[model samples]
Target: MEFDTPVLDNHLHLDPENGRGMEAVQDFARSGGTHLLVVNKPSWTLGIDVDEPADFRAAFETTIDIVDEASELLGGRAWPVLGVHPGLVSHLTERGFTPDEAGELMQAGLDIATEYVPSEALALKSGRPHYDISADVWDASNRVLQHALALGAENDCAVQLHTEASEDLTEIADWATERDLPAHRVVKHYAGGRLVGPMPSVMSEKDRLAEAAERGEPFLMETDFIDDPERPGAVLGPKTVPRRVRWLLDEGFDDAVRTAHVETPRRVYGIETLG
Candidate 1:
């Protein structure tokens, strides 16, 4: 199907298991996908901690190294968005890395990642979740975010942020704005704010998207809901993606919805889709 606008995918995960590594991205571009923002969320990707592995530092180091390799492989076709996930924040803290050290580690990761990943793929402040209780933790989280923003500015890439709770999105917007980046440039994901409780019925997704549009804010929609007889909440049938896309399109806000799902994300991360 032909879309009126460029179909940039704001949220895409790199599953090492897929074997495409970074090379598969080229295929996405050929299919008329304009851009892709590859996000590395440990819990979602590795099913383990970012700080895990016998070689903690190496685990972090290797992620960037692979990303850098992928960047070079995908070239302009893909961009990288790297960060320490909030769920993994506690894990990093327990390792006794100061906020400064954590920020430094992230930078090193980006440096190596970009070598393989496109320079257009940039560093992002990821992993800040709401369940974190320490006010001081926010300070650490902010430090990481600030560092990523600075790096992003230097490289001319946008930052992707994930807030644990939906209520915190406004604050996140404020932070991004303070960094001199457009609020829209601060891409968010996972329906991180959408699956609040119980089952997420279709109407819930509709209401949230409507609210975000009314406020002129970008909304995140996901196609990765995994359905399981044992764990029904995990599956996202393929039908869901086009359904949600159709909903936004039917609402007559096709441009805005398309941007959130594709264009804005591509512009921010520096990714091009391959067919």
Candidate 2:
């Protein structure tokens, strides 16, 4: 299926050493995808033990390299979103660091990530864990999240969140407002439905996409493709976004396709073109 507007996958990770890497991207391109927000995988995924903030550089650089390669392959259709993955707190604590120490390290990592913004990277990625945790860890995570929001505001870019599933995010929205980052610029990755605060990057599920489209509000689409060979197609396949856009077109939701694939992303990421 041919699309007049750009087809974007808002959240994706590629690991050449451990996963399909460019082969997965090729599948997306073959299925009509034009643009990607290539997010940084967790530092642990790259076998990095983050004892200090500088340890994040390797993972961020790897993501940036992937973005560059993807752009070269697709003619400037990729952008890097780099930051410390929120789950790093648990990993750090498990490695003997206290919760507060973990939080401080994560914030410092985000500070380094901010240095690449509006240059090597287009946005930041950070959020609290989506699973059960102790109170101290949760508080630390929120601190990191607040810092991410402030950094996004300072850098004039978006912050893609990997957070717990919730029907409303008014608290997060309020935090963004407090930090001077526009609510729309705070994207909720892997969203299952339309959310109240941050912009929902709805997973490419037909029913959820259809429901989000029905609202006609500004939102983005994503596959959250982890690109892990061990768990192939964990969240969704890389080609899912383009294929779902095709489904939306077939269902006569042309406006939704335009909003999800082009308009919303352009506004949120501040990208001039998806091509």
Candidate 3:
């Protein structure tokens, strides 16, 4: 199948060491995907025990390299979004670091990630844990999230957030506002439906895509394909966005498909020629 407009997967991972890697990207391209925002996996997933901030460099570099290689193979573009995953907080605490210490380490890691923005990386990823946690740990996570927001503001790049499911993102929008990051640039990854605040990278589900289109709101589409060989098709597959967009186009949702797959991503990520 071919798409008239670029098909972008806003959040995807390619693990060359442990998963199908570029082969999964091939699946997306064969399904008509054009662009992607390849996000970095958690440090531990890359076998890096984050005892220090610089330890994140390997993971970030790997993501950059993947983006470079994927872009060469892709019909369109592939930009890297590097950062410290919010789950790193739990990992750090479990490794014997206190909540505050964990937060500090995460913030430092994000600081390193920012150095790559607008050049090696196109955006930064950060958020609090979606699952339950102690208040102290939650607070620490919030601090780290705020730090990421600040970095996004400073770097003039988008920030992809992975947080608990919520119908509204007013609170997070406020955080972006305080940091001077455009609310629209603060994307809520894995979003289920139309949200109240912050731009949503809606998961590529048929019903949800139709709902967002019907509302005529600007949004982006994503698969969040983890590419883990151990759990194939976890979250969603690499070809999901293109497949869903093809269906929406067949259903006469052309305008929505254009806005979600092209316009929204171009505006938010500052890519002038995405489609």
Candidate 4:
């Protein structure tokens, strides 16, 4: 299936667990996937203890290497989304690190991300339903989240948030509004039909997506493709987003396609795709 216009996949992971990262990029391109953002999976997902300095450094170095490689492999169609995942805060606290200590570690990760990723695509991923983080841990997560946002504001980049679409999202947007980076600077990473912030990169069914498109704000689209070998397209297939775009086109949702896939992503990430 080919697309008349380029399709942007807003979120994905392209490590070995994701299956031939370079090859996957090439395949996505052939399917008319012009742009994508690859995120570093949280430590809990990878079973690595990131509180350890060596592990943290090595993990981040490896993540940056993949992001760079993916960018090169796709000829700039790919960008890296790096920052401390909120889930890491949950994991660290479980491992007996104090909330403040976990927060400090996340701040260090953000510092490292700024050093490695020279753009606004730094992620402040937090608050997924899966993690049972304590209140103090949640506070720690917010501290790091604020730090990550500060980094994005300073760098003039977008912050991809892996948070639930709830009142907390409103607070995040309000917080950004008060800061140098406005609400749109926060890309609600893996969203659905229900919009919460000024910017939402959605991942939902066609009907719900159509509803979001009708509102006509600049909302992007993503498959949130996990790419875990064991879970094999747990969220969605690598080609799912592009195919969804095709569905939109076939269904005569051209404006929707342009807004979600082409324009919105380019606006947030500062990258262009084929028309």
Candidate 3 pairs with clashing backbones:
none
Query: Against the correct fold, how does model 2 do in TM-score?
Result: 0.98
Task: Please state the error at residue 212 of candidate 4 in Å.
Answer: 1.5
Model 2 over residues 169-213: C-alpha lDDT tens digits? 999999999999999999999897678999999999998999899
TM-score, every prediction: 0.62, 0.98, 0.98, 0.88
lDDT of 3 by residue, 33-87 (tens): 8888999999988889998899999999999999999998789989999998999
lDDT of 2 at 95: 88
Candidate 4 Cα deviation (angstroms), residue 6: 1.5
Of 1 and 2, which scores higher on TM-score?
Answer: 2
lDDT digits (tens) for residues 1-275 of candidate 1: 34454444445554545334444444444443444445664543454444422323333444455555645543244445655555455656677966655555544544443343233335464536567557766776666666555555555555665555454456555665676665555655555334322111122256666755555544545443222234435434323444455566778877656556555445554443323
Q: Distance from true position, residue 249, model 4, in Å? A: 0.8
Pairs of colliding residues, candidate 2: none
Per-candidate RMSD, Å:
6.8, 1.0, 1.0, 2.7
Model 1 segments beyond 4 Å from truth?
A: 1-6, 18-35, 43-78, 95-127, 167-180, 191-204, 213-232, 235-239, 261-275
Report residue 216 deviation for candidate 4 (angstroms).
1.3
Worst window of 10 by summed lDDT in candidate 1: 195-204
